[model samples]
Target: MSNRIVKSSNLLNSFRYQIENSQKGVLIERKALLSSKNIELHFYETITRAKDVLMQFNLPVIAVMLQGEKTVEMDGLGKFEYAPGESLIIPAERKLKIDFPSASIENPTQCLAFIPDASLVEEAVYDYYKKTDTWDTKSDDGKIDFSADLLLRDEAILQTVNYLLYLFQEKNEHRDFFINMTTKELIIRILQSKARKAFLNNFQKNENRMTHIANYIKRNIGNPISVQDLSKEANMSKSNFFTLFKNSFGISPNEYIINEKMQKAKIIIQASSDRSIGQIARDLGYSDSSYFCKQFKNHTGYTPRQYERKHN
Candidate 1:
């Protein structure tokens, strides 16, 4: 709760002293894959000044600042900030700088970073994600820019932090299977705790409202339905329904509808090489050929004709 987040300099020294020039401390390249989703808690600590920056040509990383503060610029996630009790996320294959500025001789910054190997995130963690693609689980190339101060106090999330500390400490000497077991548990706790919180926040009441609305829209994907009519089906005033729909899913209802339609349109276009753009557009409920082409071009950045020609 101290605004005095453990400064980067102090934590770095402590991490180095603890590692004691251990051979594993010399790992220039660290990589691991968790049995679970985007949960590779790949940890690294530097005792002396780290001259070379952390660079992975094609790997996604999600870092939890275990201790200290650090400024980083990663390949795809862009400029990011970190301090104790915060998670600094970077996309895979990003080139990043770990600026452990010299604050004082006595204290150096220490850090614990998690790199979500994309394959695992896609296969495991993403598979169990609560929300739809709106959260953008499809790509592992973004940052976790929320104020982690609000999230740090979460007891469950903190417990995972403690678990990481414990695992790394034991890993220093113990080759025991229990270290791996504890490590595995730490990953799962994060998914259930932090990731699940995200899911619950969105889909908690979605079963009836969000799901029903989405399902109805999907069932009528072949029909042209206006926002007012969709609002009526939800039994809420147009404005109120629009507000709630966006709040629950974090995008306007019309945008959501368009996104879903585009997804279906992409599939249809991809599947039948013979289907003309007009046929596909009509099946998807757009009566105006030019309008459909424009919408598709905006959503996908490729006009229907261009898309078909390129893909087919």
Candidate 2:
């Protein structure tokens, strides 16, 4: 997925004068709009950078871009651009190196980073799985994969962020209680966006069998997998499995497996310098490093070394 620039809200510019005049020169300067026991609203601004600024957050963040452009290199995902009207979810513990290629004194890059409560996230994820019939209750990894970093702005989420910003401005005894309620609602909207994405992935049924198999494959990617084994796992005959798999995803089961393996390999290649190509190959059940290299090149236009060079 790629970073998207959605329609910006009028409310976003309400603090522009304060944000623009307050910072300059620092790689990724920030101002705290509001900080509570469970919620944090931050204003992040950066000027045109001669160098990249590295950032890491302990908590998961929902970053809403309000002004200017930024090219970000994320851990698993390669470099991408974030601009106004766009919002992205940063998975907890992911490191990012961001560069403000288009930012300058006249037009600085401004954004809102929303750090919601961890317990609220867990609660939302739990409630989503509990209510949704699509989820496999037998699976131990019940949490949603918020790792898909790029999220195009949806009106519902943007509106929630806007409402939260407005809530921060209020000074009343029940402010905390109302903010807590809105935070939970925001969590639900985020979960809804995820659910919508999952739905779009399958395009068949709500409890999409192919989606289930895809998730299963991701979880057991390290193991030796075969079409026959996967068919049995899905409780379908070989022919039926092949047909269904092809219909759900345009690719065959074997191709899909290789694609998933290579995707994992790309992440490893970007994340670590210590792991040899052979080690990554073997970890993905490829016994022959040469064959793995060939497959990697065939799948992605670049070989492991070339991919590393481009990303590093």
Indicate which candidate wins on lDDT. Answer: 2
Task: Mark the regions of model 1 whose C-alpha exceeds 4 Å error after superposition.
Answer: 1-41, 49-57, 75-81, 103-108, 117-120, 123-155, 164-312
Question: How many collisions between residues are there in candidate 2?
Answer: 0
Distance from true location, Cα of 269 in model 2, Å? 57
Clashes of each: 19, 0
Tens digits of per-residue lDDT, candidate 1, 27-65, equal: 332222232232344444443444336555344344566
Q: List the residue pairs that clash in candidate 2.
A: none
What is the model-wide C-alpha lDDT for candidate 1? 0.54
lDDT by residue for model 2 (69-151), tens: 78878787577777677678775677898887776656667788877665555455456656884543222343334335246
Scored against the true structure, residue 199 in model 1 reaches a CA lDDT of: 25
